[model samples]
Target chain A: MSQATLNRLADAGFSGWTTVTGRTLAAYQAAVVRIGVALTFGGFLLREWPHRRVLYGDLSPWSGDLARQMLASNHAFTVLAWSDGRWWFEGVYAAAIAVSVLMLLGWRTRATSLLFMVLVLSLQNRAVLVGDGGDNVIHLMAIYLAFTRCGQVWSLDARAARRGTRRTGDPVGVVVWAALGLALAYCQLSGFASLGMLDFGLYSWGTFFWLCWLLAGLRGLLARRAPEGEGLALLDALATLVHNAAMLVIAAEVCFIYATAGWYKIQGSLWQGGTALWYPLHLHYFEPWPGLADGLSGSSTLVTAITYGTVIAQVGFPFLVFNRRIKNVMLTLMIAEHLGIAIVLGLPFFSLAMITADAVFLPTGFLARLGQGVARGVARIAATPVVRQTIMRAPRTPERDPEAVSVIR
Target chain B: MADEPDEATSPEPIPPLAETPDLPDEERRWSLPSLLVLYLTAVAVAVAVVYHLGTVFLSIAPANPVSQRHATAINAHVLPEFEQNWQLFAPNPLQQNIAVQARVQTVDSTGHRLDSPWIDLTARDVAAIRGNPLPSHVNQNQLRRAWDYYTAWHDQQTEKSTGFGGPLSEEYLKRIGLQRIGRDWEGMAVIQIQFRSATTDVTGPSWTGAPATTSPSYRQLPWWPANDDDYRGLGVS
Candidate 1:
């Protein structure tokens, strides 16, 4: 790489990094992934609840000895694998479930999101063989979510923050600022420590803070240069960068999954013959209902069309995303195809998982409308006097901006 | 010089921090502390963004000769949790229906061969999951994976890629077979397991081309020493 070429690359990278600052982003859009993932996991838990003991409990058919031997060969690690004791397993298992619920409700989201990631890692790691494509997508998404302001809206934490702000009076008193600072410190520190930042050996965390102060002091001596009303929002900018970057990364992941699948299908002789669809229809493991499977397999024209349609959709999905109209047409068909897979293959979680991940690419406007419609429905239901009184016990006061109280440095 | 104020409009020297409690976070940006924080934060973000994108790139890398060069780094970065492959009913869907069944041979004090009847483990899964909207993870993945693990070890072709006969497979088959019988048999000292795979060449939707279906072939494993390690099976049984 020549210096000029390197310079050009650096310039390009710098431009790409700055573009997110100007681009339109709806952080709240991530709520869809959160809600979808939580519901899917919750549904998974409920379905797996009865069998939990046998699958993961101390009483599992895979005895402790067998499991240890298996783990020794596999080189996979999980906190659950540390012990096969029933009580220890149950406690850790229960804690994972509770943390997931808390994360779903968006209570102390930063902390809960971290815990949720750990839980997914621990549980999924414990049984490596028993996870499908759905588990893979969720695993990556959980870690990506840790960097986001995922609790910005539609969460219990958001609601409480809003409520707390409303209860405080204007002039934004000194006490309020101090209290807010303390709260921010507490919450942020919890998240930081959970992420293992507090483990910086030799140097105390306070020293790091002191160094930052010294740097800020030296930086203060430099002349101010930013345009007026530009809040710097340095931390906010970092958060946005990370959040957007993750979204892009995950979206790329989904696209590549489709592209590779399509590309491989393109390579296969069966697909070229247009008889590729005939196999899955006949596969007994996938055949949940023989009558239905055979019923669908009866039409050669339908089968060929579907086979070609799936290939075309998966192959074209990446290209289509660059064009709005085409993207909409393609995504609709893709979603439908996944739904079809769910019904035909009897893999609801896998389909829903893909659909949920795809939902991230859905236009913010569409999600906003969906959110509004849901809110409207809730409001309409609340019109019933008894229901309204029960759910809305707090007397009506205008909702306040939670960020208004964030006056502390 | 040109921007300086005259004697009539001279500005006061800046006040010390202890006297400036009223300054909000943004107003204090010109301070050395906040600017230092901002610069440090930007640097941190840059490093983090680079690391994350690098890992993600490797994880979702395209399958090509170019990517093969970085295969080791990609593998290290994406091993375990993020390791990805796009091979779910891909290019070609499976044409075989494999049923894993387990039966036991028991010996009494008289050395008589008492037999435990064959149990269709996959059948129970099919029945439990067939009409149900939400299938348990066990139903979704366990038996299929168990069979896959077994075959991956046993298959001659797979051995060329992923070497087989690891302890994982050894324990894995035992777990799956034992799960079928609830693991406990008072007199059973040994267990035997087998599978039947029924395959058919996919005929056209027209069902023409001299319709061909291969007879289901049975593959059995040698009897393994049994342990009385039966925990109650998932309540589905």
Candidate 2:
């Protein structure tokens, strides 16, 4: 290429990188996804608490030995397989719930996100057969959520950042960090990290965790030493770049899920005949409400339309995402389908999880409006005399400026 | 930046971080050396993004020679941790209802032989899921998928183990059956076990005149010896 062409390419690349590194993209959407995933998984854990032993604990049909053999062949990693004791299983399950709540509230999101990913992988991989489609969605999203700066908005971390209160001297934050460091070090020094599970060299959890810890430490040091220097600026830019890339990856992943499902259905003779949706309604396992399933399938036209619509909507999803209006329409349709699945099919968690995944495609303007509407609604409720007296024991504080806290960077 | 893998539907471009209203005061223009470093970093990130997405696409797309040629690399990228199949009721929705039944042979203290009736384990799962608005995942999927896994690893015609997972699946199915039976066979030592599945076709709406078969075809397997290993960890050994 000529000198002028080279110069143009360099300039274009520089500006593109600048946009990605300068500010986090889809900040509101990412925060919502973080909340949705955390809530869904947390709710799932609590609901299954009574059957924890049968589902994932030592009392389960899938013993630790069986899980180990399976994991060895598949190269999966899970801390639950480290021991077969009842106490060990209970402890890990409880920690998973705790971290999930922390992630939902977006407290110390960078650390909590990693813990959330690990726990989700641990429990889900332990009883691989006990999960459905929802578990798979959470499994992949949890890992991707770690790479995102999802707490940039609508989070306690963001609130602290806006208030100019650094967490450097916070005792709770310090203890959490130290504890994680010690645990990770022990795993490394011992042979736990060398169990050959997920032995993808650089792509392994051992490398990922150690890298995150070191980077966080370096970020803290740089912030204190040269808060405004180019070194910190560069680090911030790189983090922004990663956050943007992760967000894009998430969107692509959702698209792939729908596209593959739709295309595969096209090859089926049942789907081609446009009567595919009727069979599941008649099955004993899927028919939670026999009357409802029967009533819905009674109409030949409705069943055919839905079966065809589902295939069309899912197949066109990836391409339609480029258009704003069509994308929103498809998003609404998909959410409605999930709601129907929850009520009629009795797969509430699976429906909730699919809805959460669809939330990433929601428009930013709508989310901002939602947040404001919620704030106003809460204020109105609190203003009522009976509720106000019951909830408030002191004078209410003044509201802070919204712009200050709403900044994405 | 059209080639950037960003959401194209953003109504407006956001301002750069340095220029945002709430950002701390800092230098906007970069030095030539810093600019060079930033340019190289951008190139590297773009390359990584492409490579990662390529592998993900290969994993999700229908299997072919491209995915096969790169099978080892793709498996390393997607197995166990990131493995996904979104073929939700695809290629064909299930058109049959399969009921798995198991029976046990137990010996009394005097060595008297007795055979228990075949118990419909799948019906038990269906009962648990019937009226409950929120059925547990264990009730909804464990046995159903275990049977599916077992069949996937074993041949239906000859009923022979097909792969390493065949025996594993048998152990899994046996444990589930034993757990359900509980202490019903208390003092008698169960010596043998066998499984059979009745498959009934799900006919379409009556208007379609799809020929319905009222009788379910049965596939029964030979008796499998109940060793200590099958009962291990199930609290029955």
Candidate 3:
């Protein structure tokens, strides 16, 4: 290559590196994802609290030993497999709920995000036979969400950042890190639960956790020692690169879900005949609102329209992502379709999960306005005399951080 | 929102360099070696992204020679953790309601071998889900997916093990039956349990005037001995 061409390429590469290191992409969208996912999984857990024992506790038919065997053979990870006792199960279950709430409120999200991933995986893997499509989406997104700087906006961390409060010596964070470090040591030394750490096998989630823990510790040390040094900047740049890459993967994963679902439907004769949706409506198990389902399915044209619309949306979604207006229109349609599914099919969790995954691709302006509107509503509620006299206090509107808002393409 | 047009519409659409944030003066004036490192890292990221997406695509796409040829590699990448199936309602959505009923043979104190009446496990699950807006995952998928798992691992006609997952699924279903059944009859020790699934095809919409096949077909499994672990888990003994 000519000297000029090579120099141009090098300049472009350096610019790209700067962009990756300078700012997180789609901060509002990531916050929406954090809130939506945490709500869906956490809400599902609370909803199923009454049946917790039969679902995942010691009373579960799929015994702990059985789950452990399956998990080991499948190369999956879960702390629930650490013991066969009911107390262990209860501890993990309760911790999962607490972690979910923490992550939802975006408190110490850098750590809570990782814990959120672990708890989601632990509970889901404990009773693999008991989940639906929604559980699958949560399973994947929890892992991806950990890598992104999702708490950059609309979070307690963001608020602290705006207030110029550093977490350099935060006691709670230090305690959590120390506690987890001790737990890892115990699990590793005991060798009682495998924990995937000992195997160091390819595809072992244990390996992933160890690497995450080590990297987090290194980053923490670097920040404490030399916050403004080149080492910290380099680490931050690498993290940003991973974050951007993970966000892209998340978006592509959503498209793949829709594309595959849509393409598969096209090959099905039932979908081709435009009566595929008619069956689920009549199934007794799926008919949460039988009267509503009956009324909707009574019209052949409605059935055909829905079936075709669903297929067309799914198949065309990946291709239309390049067109902003069309993609937004289709995104609305998809969200509405999920709402319809939630009501008609009695799969609220599944629908919520899908909607949350779709939120990652939501237009930034809409999400920003949504955040503002919510803030205004909360401030209004807190200002009421009845609430103010009691314990509720009005919150000052958070100052928008320019760094958080700036989009780096 | 003038920059609204800059939203990510495609997978990795890079905007104009003018929008790129300028680094600090010190970092901007990097050594040649640092510049080389940046170029290499950027190239590495691009390659990694392409390879990861390709694997994901192959994982989700329909069965083809390319995917089949790399099934082992794909399985390693996607199985257990990332394994996914997007056939939401494809090939055909379920049009049949399959109710799994379990009957147990027990020996009373009088030494008489009597068979208990069939208890519809699926009806119980369906009942739990019917009026509830947020049915538990156990109610929605436990018994249903258990049956699907069992059937997938066993042949329909011969009711024979077809794969390695057959026996595990059998134990899983049996344990579910044992737990759900409990110990109804006092002083009776349950010896064996059997499951019979009655599947009825859903009637077509009234507008279509499609013929209804309401008659149910039965798939009965051979009797399975209720072992000590099953009884012990439920404190049945």
Candidate 4:
């Protein structure tokens, strides 16, 4: 290309930045903030709850014991020892749970986010033997949320009267933009990890999940741009383009998951009759009611229906999301499906985390209302002088600017 | 410089619209150094938490000591028995079947391995030689159930075959008793044996002869003379 042509192209690109458009940007921000808060709440609840016992029963103790053996083996991956069933490990687990709960409560929100991420990641990394994909996804999301100003809008810290009004500036916008980018990267990486390499075959559903997440991120990044106006900033345009691209990626990913999984299941005879469901339900480690298997032996029709329903849902989930009513119906079905698996198949924690992710499909307005209620409650608590004094007394470095804190408000 | 337009004609730069404006100080943007520190701190904290949890999990012993100990003891005892009756690869693909015979000796609180008059038992499998089925033991019960299934299935298959010996002879039935009769069998050991075959097929390039198509055929017989020396060598004499 000639220098003149290149200069022309650059000039055109520069000029494209000045044109602003519709309510798309604000829509994006509202979606991202709502989703972020919901995830924060869900993840915190899981961490704080005695999830091990809920999921694994008394056998949960085995996780710690296994850790000890791995340590004594002096294996190269000795970090596995960290999960060894010991009092110290329990203490660490408890502390992590505590921090996550604190995060949800919006008390020292940033500090808790950091602590929760560290604790959860540490526990997860130490024991590959005990982990599922849900654990890894939650861990990664926690890390991303930690770096982002996730607590800025919905948190108790933001509601504090003494903290003054929320500060507005270029840096805050830049950080928000960066966070949006990070969120996109995180979801895409997770999708690639599960579908591309791991061949989880959940790609069909995962694609939709990713697109939703990407759109949500883009919305946040472009929030400052005026809705339905001219002279859009370069950043706003870039944000919109990225957001749209993410939606496409999400759709493609979901399609891949459904098609691949559907085909795989078609090859199995047990899936046709729902015998496949029985396998997980019968597994001694996970079975909630072993006696139920004997009673269900005559229910061939029920079994077949469940099998057919599962396959249809798996394959049809992506396309269904295009229609709002159908999407809501399918989402409800998926949630119920997960709930059944958790209780009947003995995978409660996994089910809970998955349900949390599916919460993205919920209306942003509903989430925003929930956030508003939480903020009001926080404001009431912050009115006390004792609470204010306690917060002020917390150890902080001089570099931790009061101004920077105010921007989050 | 001399021919420049007048100050008023030069025109002032357009001021940006009044909106959420940028902070005056650029230092407000999170510094790269600070971000790096935060990232490192997060990782360090995670590592510490993992390390602390691992130590706690490893120290506990398996939940069922009696059964676990029994399993370990059986492994030790059966390892020798396996070596004695089973041949290493031999005869161009070892195919050997040897029967094992033994009596149960229960250990009392006094530490003596003595035959208990109260117990009457039947032979099961090699793993069961260290102890009989315990009603309270889930693993032991499962193993017993599996042994029963195998025995019944094997008998049915043998009976259906045209060339098999008539249902196991009365003499053999007398030697290995029928269905275990009483609770006295609980801690008593029984002897059992398994028959396995290993075969290898080797082929070389066709020889340049009158008939290049001809292939060699080889088969090793099943029966081999018992060697007392082999049993001693196995540390099971």
Candidate 5:
């Protein structure tokens, strides 16, 4: 192309580019909000008023042994440091959970968010066998939230007495934006990795489905801030189209997972009549409930129905999840599937992690409302003057000029 | 704004712009150091997450865990089944089959020349002849198969060679029944033999434009043994 033509094209592209930048920045802002909510909620869930342990304590000895083995294998990494007979790991886990709870509560929000990120990374690094995809997603988001203005609103840090005294513009938002970009890159890599596993074709399908859900979730968030314009509108329109395309790719991946798994299971003779359900129960490693397998075996019809149902549910999940009613039913079936696997197959940790990711498909409004409720409860306790004063007096930027506040925010 | 005279040109070098911005109270923009720190921290966290999760996901499915355990259990249950199923079927059989026949001259504890009667044993029954029911300690099944394998080759040598006297000298024969043999130098009590099969010339009907012949003929060749020395050479001292 001629230089004149190239210049013209560049000029045209610049306008579209700025709009994209603006939209992306807005998306980053929204992502920060979502991440903040997730962290705060997760943190609160960690803290126990009565000092009771819930999730980690429930992990079986096999799971613990597996974690120890993983830690031992990767000793050079030293990602997980366990000393004093479980004191270090347990202490870190508890502290992380507590910080996560505090982050959710929005009390000393930034500090807690930072600590939570550190602790989570430490725990995750120490034990490769204990985590799942949800842990990965949450950890990534938590790191982003730690550096963002996630505590700007609906937080004890925000509602302090000296609220307007603090400088609003912090590069914490930029850090979060970078983190989100990294997350996108990670998900893309994860998707490609899943596709690489050709031998376990059906398992790849599951991974593909997961990647699709991740893309769809991200797309849904991005769609809210799509730009408005005439020529710019067309660019925005193209972005939406791309987002839709991403969603379709994810959908296709999900379909592949279910279809391949269904086919593989059905092709196997033992899986058709429900006799295979007892196989897991018979295995010493996986038998969580021993007699239950015998009971399931006795009812061949029930077992067969479950087998057929699992195949149908898995195959239909991508399509069915689109429909609100069917989605709920599918969600229920997925839960049941995981629960059944946990009891019969003894994969409690895996089942729980998978179940948690499935929760992402629940109505965003429902989660938002839950977040609001938690925020309200936190606000009530944190309304005291002493707590307010402590947060307000925590830190202040050197610039006290009120005029500069509106320049950034 | 232009009428307000340029600050530097108008009068007494209107105090440096840096000094005029209300000392420490001036608007403090986000600094590069702060941004760098936050970015580094975020990147570090990202790395940790990826490293931890990647290792976990990759390590979930191992190929040999169940197979290793099951092989041990199966071995315990059916040892004889492995013994009964041995066979010597290679695509192309070796030309020079070697055998070792040895007689150990030693008393069983009383220092007498061990003149035990010659025991007739089939090559396939060497494991039984040696009175060692179990296979060797090596994990590879091929090693166990090798024992039955080379013994069959030795049997083929004894059967093919009519006059074994040239290679099977008295000194060599004495070594066979007591000491070690084979490429691996495995020590075992057994006879060693070595010989080469004679090459045969084919003479048949001319179905494919070739001349027909009346008979097939064979020629003898010197034997090249597989093992270093014949089994008869090694005596149990």
Candidate 6:
């Protein structure tokens, strides 16, 4: 490259860094997406816990060999496939459930998010034909989350960071280092769980994040010990730039999905004529409550309006996203629409997954305020003697940190 | 209105988001290496994003010109992890309750051949879902996908006017019937499987003073020879 070209490229890269670092300030929105996805999975795991074997066990309606064939077709992997033995499947299943709970709690999020992806992909892949739009959304969202600092708020990791203890780094670093060491060692000892993935790149997710956390702890210590904390503008710039761009891409991805779906619907005679929802309403598979669907389907005008309104809201959504007022209105409309789909179509998981993705588009301030209001309400309710006796009767343990009581909504 | 307190009359307006966020205890000056890190992160993210967007575009309309241009590449890279189709109930809503049913070929008391009782799988699924607060997701998928998989064969095979109800459909229905019946369910000598759909025409509503007798109309398929592939990979048999 010429000298001038080199200088220009360098300058542009620097400028890009500056622009992104400044703009991608808040991690709050990312945190909401993480929590929402995590919570949805938490519910799913809980609901499916007793029937986990039925879903993915050797004796599932979808047989194990068939599942393996399906997974192989999709280039997906699960520890269950490594060994035909029942113990391996059970161990792997337990690990997935544990990772899900951790994701929900937002502890060690950087590691858990990737594991969450693995679990979603593996389980969904295991029963590919039995999956839906919601499962696919979750699959994609889990992958997207690994690029984000989703545990920056409303998470146990965030609470730890929030503590920001002024005590000498020795104790904190030692404790954190010990915890990480134990976790890595535990992973090594958990041979059966990691058996299928031992030879693969999936095992690195734990080691990679552990190293990161360890390095961060050491960095925190050194920064406090010395006056200057690395003072690396490049690192900060890079972090900010990645966060901003990734978030923008995720948002755009969602918008594209909606626009494309809407576009497809628009081409259909049913959608254009506003009788699209009528068939689904009458379908036995979608009818959770047949009476409710039948009662609602009785009205022609309402059905047509809903059908047309759905198409309009979805088609015009990409344009609305740039304008806060329109976006807010659209978000409400979309959430309501998804809720209807959930109830009328017997697709709670799909609706919830879509709604979780939509929550990211909502302003962080709005969500935070809502969280705060809920927190306050809970506090008020807890103050009552009867409520306190019933709920707060359990013996309390000392908090990890006094300042860690933000209780991110 | 004039007597309203000053605080009530004029509250402070919130600042626009373009202004720097007033985050608590988050202030830190930008350093050069930090900036470099930010740039590098952006670069990495940008590459991944391009790939993600590419796959998403391909998945949306795989037959479109742009998608077809890169079809070979997409099949290799994107089709594995990101292969998706959004056509749930699209183009037109599925205007029918496609109840997959089966009838076992049996011997009558009069030494004559006969098709046994019709077992409605769709009805079983509906019954399973009705009272349960947390219905198994498979209940929603099992019969539907079976029917869809059966129907998809036609679109892939020769042109068919009606959905999966032609000459070669028996093998497909037998596979689905075997899936439902499995090795258990009394292990009866089930010979064949067929399907019926109760189609509803919403374009013409009962409320419009049309024939109130527009109840669920059942269109049953002819029984296929109970194929052995139904028992092939199920592992139960």
Q: State the C-alpha lDDT per candidate.
A: 0.60, 0.80, 0.78, 0.38, 0.38, 0.63
Assess the local accuracy of residue B160 in candidate 1 as a C-alpha lDDT between 0 and 100.
26
Provide the lDDT at B55 for model 6: 67
Q: Which stretches of candidate 5 lie above 4 Å from their native place?
A: A1-78, A81-91, A103-121, A129-269, A339-349, A365-409, B1-237
Candidate 2 residue A387 Cα shift, in angstroms, is 4.4
Clashing pairs in 3: none
Please compute and give the TM-score of the first chain of candidate 1 against the native first chain.
0.73
Worst 10 residues of 2 chain A by lDDT: A400-409
Candidate 1 per-residue lDDT over residues A1-409, each given as its tens digit = 8999999999997665455532224445567777777666666666677777766766565555655565555444455665677787787678777776776787655446655776676677667677788888778777767655566556665555545532222222223333434543563456522223223434333344334333322222221233222243443344455566666666777787788778778877778777788778766456566677788878878888988888888889888888888887887888888898788877787788888777776776676667678879988888655454456563453542234224211
Please say which candidate is ahead in DockQ: 3 or 5. 3
Q: Which prediction has the highest DockQ against the true structure?
A: 2
Could you list the CA RMSD of all candidates, in the order they appear? 11.2, 6.7, 7.6, 22.6, 25.3, 9.6
Interface RMSD of 6: 11.4
Candidate 4 wrongly placed segments (more than 4 Å): A1-91, A107-111, A132-137, A143-149, A158-263, A273-275, A290-298, A369-409, B1-237
Candidate 3 lDDT score at position A100: 88
Say which candidate scores most in lDDT.
2
| Superposed Cα deviation of residue B213, candidate 4 (Å) | 49
Per-residue lDDT of candidate 4, residues B1-237 (tens digit): 010011111123212122111121122233566445434643554463343222211111122554354555433322211111111011111111112222233445555554423221212332332222111111222223222322343434332312212222211221222112211224532222122112122211112122332232322122112223212211121
Model 3, span A1-409: residue lDDT tens: 9999999999997666567755567777778888889999999889988878778888887887677767768867677777778788888889889988978988777778988998998888888888889999999989889888777667776666555454444544556677777776677778855646335655465566677677767766665677656655565666667778888888999999999999999999889999999999988778878888989998899999999999999999999877989988988999999999998999999999999998888877777777778989999977655455444442333643334234221
Lowest lDDT block of 10, candidate 6 chain B: B1-10
Fraction of true contacts reproduced, model 6?
0.28
Q: What order do candidates take by lDDT, descending?
A: 2, 3, 6, 1, 4, 5
State which docking tier applies to candidate 5.
incorrect
DockQ of every candidate:
0.21, 0.33, 0.32, 0.02, 0.01, 0.19
Predicted candidate 3: what Cα RMSD to the true structure? Answer: 7.6
